[model samples]
Target: PLTVLQGYLEMMQEQVLEGATREKALHTMREQTQRMEGLVKQLLTLSRIEAAPALAMNDRIDVPMMLRVVEREAQTLSQEKQTLIFTVDEQLKVLGNEEQLRSAISNLVYNAVNHTSPGTEIRVSWQRTPQGALFSVEDNGPGIAP
Candidate 1:
C-alpha cells in the first residue's frame, strides 16, 4: 500500500508539472496520503502490541469500564453508522495488565467494525466464568463460512 501511495504521489507530481488541473491532482494526492497514513498507523499499533508481553500482572481492571472503552472506540471506527452495545455484569473485575486487556478487546471490536456493514450492530458482552472472565463481540454480519 505504501508503494502504491508513493507511485500515486509521483504520478500526481508529474501531472502537476505537466500543467494538469491542480484541483484534481491535489485531491487525489491528499486521499492517497491519508490512506497511506492510516495503514502506517495500523502497522505501528500492531507492532507495539506484539512487542509487549502477552500476559502481565498489574492493576485490577473493571470489566465494565473496559467494555465501555471498547464500545466507544468501536463506535468511533464505525463512523456513527454502526452502534456498539455492551453488556457486563456488575462488580466484574479482572487481575491483569490493563493495557494488554484493552488492546485485546479493542482489536476484537475493531475487527467487528471492519467486517460488518454500516448500520450493523455490534454486541459486546462479558461474563464471569469459573476460571476467568470471557469477553466476546458479536456482530449481526456475515458469519464465518462453513
Candidate 2:
C-alpha cells in the first residue's frame, strides 16, 4: 500500500494526471496512508504483546462503538469500489484490548476490501453470541485457493 501511495504521489508531483484523475489519486493516497497507520499500530501492538503477554488482554471494551469507528474507516478505504454493510448490536461489549480489538476488526475489513473485486458487498457485523460477542467480516468475493 505504501508503494502504491508513493507512486500516486510521484504522479501528482509530476502533474502527470489532472482534474478528476488527480482527485481520485489524492483520495487513494489518503486511503493508503490510513491503512499504513493501522498496519503500524498492529505491529506496535504485537511487539508489546511479545514483551509482556498478560498486559495485552483484560480491558472492558465497547465492541459496538469500535465497530462504528471501523465502519467509518472502511468507507475511506473502500472508495466506492465496494459496498460496506455493518450490522452492529449497540449493546454488545467484551473483554479485550481496545487497540488489539480495533486492529483485528480493521484487518478483517481491510482484507475483504483488498481481496474482493469492485462492486462486491462486504459485510461487518457484531452480534450477541451464546459464548459472547461475535464479530465477523464477510464478502461475496472469490474464495482463496486451498
- Which digits, one per residue and each the tens of the lDDT, describe model 1 over residues 14-127? 754444555665667777787777668878888987886666676888878878766677777789888888889868888888877787787778878877888778888898
For model 2, how does the per-residue alpha-carbon lDDT over 1-146 read when each residue is reduced to its tens digit? Answer: 98999898787788788789988998998998988997798788778867875654678898887787878888988898999999999987888778767766777788788778998899888889888778888897665468
Error of 2 at 64 (Å): 1.2
Instruction: Report clash pairs, candidate 1.
Output: none
Leading candidate by lDDT? 2
In order of appearance, the predictions have TM-scores of 0.69, 0.64
lDDT score for residue 120 of model 1: 71
Measured with C-alpha atoms, the lDDT of residue 17 in candidate 2 is: 88
- Which 10 residues in a row give candidate 1 its minimum summed lDDT? 15-24
Clashes of each: 0, 0
Model 2: which ten-residue window has the lowest total lDDT?
49-58
